[model samples]
Target: MGTTVLEEVVRNYRGQPEKLIAALLALQRHYGYLPEPALRVISQELRVPLSKIYGVATFYAQFRLQPRGKHTVCVCLGTACHVRGSEQIFHQLRRELGIEAGETTTDGRFTLEVVSCVGACSMAPIMMIDEDLHGRLDADKALALLTQYRD
Candidate 1:
């Protein structure tokens, strides 16, 4: 991120340690992941420890240290989803995308992940592509939906 922009973000939350999470979140939004230089700037400018900053970043799943694909595919493995065959769907996606869970496709088009639940148990056996949820899916149906995001 540009120093000017980073400075502005620090200025917005200057002297407010409680807003550390918010500042980090804003940086993540801008850069797609928390860049080390940005974190250092935040630590120095905000007088917070670098270790503390990293602690918070690592504590939350929302923060990503590495670059991510343009899209994230989350397969639910909750009890209801498991019973409905989400595992098979997940395996199909893994084979088709050539990536295991927590891995991004070589083309960076998609990142595959497994989540415990998305709170849509009624729509069990669901997989989410970005923010859109596709439910009641079999292996074939899940693969079919991938066509829409292939590009």
Candidate 2:
């Protein structure tokens, strides 16, 4: 995002440094991730150093620095999922997508990530694509599920 949309967001917060996190959040919602240039705009408008702004962005896991993919693949790694072989499923996804955790595929179709839990222990060995949760999966089954989303 350039100064145009970001400026509007900053203007909403009255350009207050105290509102940095809130401003960043609004921007994140708009762009899906915090663009580097967008951060510069926030720094200048709020009179906060870019380094400090970066600190806040990186400090929060909710803030993403890179662009998000069309689909997000989050593999559950909590104790319940782990015992059921979530790791194998995660590795298989990484291998198939050719992108490591927190990375989007080259085609920008998918992003792979690992999560501690999703509160569905009964559905052990779970991986989610976008907002849909799939459970009780083996590595092969996980790959098969991904195929459905390829289109």
Candidate 3:
């Protein structure tokens, strides 16, 4: 293709130390995680310390230095979600996937994480499988939803 996403991110924000956070976010978006090589490039181009860049990356929950699975499964454990039996759905997912929260499956197809909220309280007991929002889920429904993503 054309210039790689990392190249674009670096070139667009080259020598702009103040834009480090934005640059890291852009790189994360492009690759789903921050690749170490990209970080080195950012350090060299932006003239910023690699330690500083890494500090910012580790400070934010949104950033992932390691590669995430193809799909991210976020379960809402907010007050409303908990009240609506989200734990039951979470249990189902854990059982079916054989992985607990904060762990990825052996196949690298799914990563299960628990979040405080997805900001959709009205649709409590919700989970997000990638970009799709699934609300009003039960044990069976959660398992079925996960099944479709295996492909």
Q: For this target, which candidate reaches the highest TM-score against the unseen true structure? A: 2
- Worst ten-residue run, lDDT, model 2? 1-10
Say which prediction, candidate 1 or candidate 3, comes out ahead on TM-score: 1
Q: Which 10-residue window of candidate 1 scores lowest in summed lDDT?
A: 1-10
TM per candidate comes to: 0.87, 0.93, 0.83
lDDT of 2 by residue, 1-151 (tens): 4567676887887568999999999999999999998888888888999999889989988999999999999999999999999999998898899999999998989999999999999989899999999999999999999999999
**Two-way lDDT contest, 2 vs 3, winner:** 2
Q: Any idea how many clashes model 2 has?
A: 0
Prediction RMSDs, each to the true structure: 2.3, 2.2, 2.2
Candidate 1 local lDDT, 58-146, one digit each (tens): 99999988778899999999999999999999999999999999888888899999999999999989999999999999999999999
Cand. 2 Cα-lDDT: 0.92
**Model 1 lDDT, residue 96, Cα:** 95
Candidate 3 at 139: error in angstroms? 1.2
